[model samples]
Target: MHVVITGANRGIGRALAQGYAQAGEDVTGTARSGDDGPRLDVTDPESCAAFARGLGDRAVDLLVCNAGVYPDKGQNLDTGYPPEMWAEAFATNVTGVFLTVQALLPHLARATAPKIAIISSQMASDSRAPGGSYIYRASKAAALNLGRNLAVDLGPRGIAVGIYHPGWVRTDMGGDAADIGAAEAAKGLMSEFTALSLASTGAFRTWDGQDHPF
Candidate 1:
């Protein structure tokens, strides 16, 4: 399978790339600097378009929209979450995913069974509100909604879309106190991506293959 993953310089994106490559799958892991495979700034429309063009007529069996930002991680709700931070967060986490998907839609359509994996967070869940990090939470929620709608629209075209929480990973972004490692998350996500089909196109799931509340 040919897989395209974004933000693969480090963390879970990197792990997913390594795992897939080891499994003998064709993997294209993209980073902003192009240090990994290709240069893909999901926040920029032209960047995404150029990356797709570089792929030529090759099929993208899987598209993993994993690039994201948590700009207001520790910001206080009373005096934090500035408008600029919100803009940055949405640009990377929300619009970025959409642009990546839009740019690669043709490549995905060329595949026999295309699958789009959107790496969202449990923070996006409206049912589990704890406040703080307003920008990250709101952006993730937007990403989740985007995946849902994309699944509906893309299902008839033989594409499957799934939004998932990669779990609290012990990476630079997740901190040292997280619950899982990048490898473990990648393994589970690989299975989730493998199981994704038109039947469960809009499913919101955890990395461990459990259903996640929207």
Candidate 2:
């Protein structure tokens, strides 16, 4: 199987890439700096288009939209979450996911059972609102919504889209106090991706296979 993962230079993305590589599957891991493989700036339409065009006719069985930003992690409610920050977060977290999917649709169509796994967050849940990190939460929520709608639209084409909350992983973004390691999250996510189908498309789920509250 051929898989394409974004933001694969570090964290959960890197782990996922490694896991798939270890399994002997063809993997293309992209980063903005091109340090890992190709330079894919998900936030830029031109960049996404170029990346897709560079792939030629390669069929991508799995596309993981794992590129995101959490700029408002510890921002103060009163003075933080500046307008620019919100823009940056949404551009990367929400718009970026859409652009990647849009550019890769044709390649995905070439696959037998193409699947899209969007790495959202539990914080995207409206029911789990505890305030703080407004930008991150809102952006992730948008991503989740996008994944759900994409699942509906792409189901007829044999492309299943699953939105996932890849546990609180111990990465630079998740911090050292996070509950799980990147490898654990990657393993669970791979299983979740493998289990995705038209019947289960649009489902908001955790990395561990549990249904997440929307």
Candidate 3:
């Protein structure tokens, strides 16, 4: 399968890219900078369009919207997180995913049983614990809404949409002290991806294939 994964320069995205490429699947991985180079900037629509246009007539079988931002790196939401941070988070985690998917929808339509997967987080769930990273949590919640909306809109067109939380994966984003490694998360996600179907569209699931509460 020909697949496209964003934020492939490091962490879980890099692991996912390697997993697919090593499996002999034709894969296009993007990042801000890297070996194959960055082909996607989540904040830019023109870049996404250009990349989609460059893919020729073959539709991408799977488009994994794994790009995200977290303020936990240097900024904490506790001691006065700027509203601008919320906007930035939504820009990449929410709006960016929407634009990327919208731009690539046509190419996705050309594929047989195409799927669009958004890399979301358990923090998105209101039912789950929500005490930190307000911006990240809110943006992911919005992303999940977008995914559900897309399921409703794209289902008729034969595209399967899903939202996934990769667990506390060990990555730059997840931190080095995280329990699950990026490779493990990628491996688990790949298994779940293969098991997806129309029936599973709009569902929020964990990397191990368990359904997560919306």
Candidate 4:
């Protein structure tokens, strides 16, 4: 199988790319700087388009939308989440995913059972709201909603979409105090991605396979 993963230069994204490559699957890992792999600025429409053109009609069985930003991680409740922070967060965390999918639709259509995996966060859930990191939370929520709707629209074309929380992983973004290691989270997420299908599309699931509350 051929898989394309965004933000794969490090963290959970890197682990996921390694796991798939080790399994003998073809993997294309993209990053914005091009130091790790192909350069892809998910927030830029022109970048996404260029990346798709570079693929040259190659079929992508799995497209993982793992690129995101959590700029408001520890912002003050009163003065935090500035307008620019919100804009940047949504541009990378939400709009980026949509642009990536839109650019790859034709390549995905060439696959037998194409699937899109969105890496949203549990914090996106309304029931899980504890009130901090407003920008990140709202952006993730939008990504989750986008994935669900994409699932509905793409199901008829044999494309499935699954949104997931990749667990509190120990990474640059997730922090050292996080609950799980990147490898473990990547392994579990690969399992979840593998299990995705038209019947189970639009599910908000955890990396460990449990259904997450929307």
Give the residue spans of candidate 3 off by over 4 A.
34-38, 72-79
The TM-score of candidate 4 is 0.99
Q: Write the per-residue lDDT of candidate 1 for residues 96-185, one digit (tens) a residue.
A: 999999999999999999999999999999987988778888999999999999999999899999999999999999999999999999
Per-residue lDDT tens digits for candidate 2, residues 45-135, read: 9999999999999999999999999999889987777899999999999999999999999999999999999999999999999999899
Model 3 weakest 10-residue run by lDDT? 71-80
lDDT of each: 0.95, 0.97, 0.87, 0.96
Q: Compared to the true structure, candidate 1 yields what TM-score?
A: 0.99
Q: Candidate 4, 141: how far from true, in Å? A: 0.4
Distance from true location, Cα of 143 in model 1, Å? 0.4
Tens-digit lDDT track of model 4 for 1-214:
9999999999999999999999999999999999999999999999999999999989999999999889998899877778999999999999999999999999999999999999999999999988888898999999999999999999999999999999999999999999999999999999999999999999999999999999
Which structure is stronger by lDDT: 1 or 3?
A: 1
CA RMSD (A), model 2: 0.5
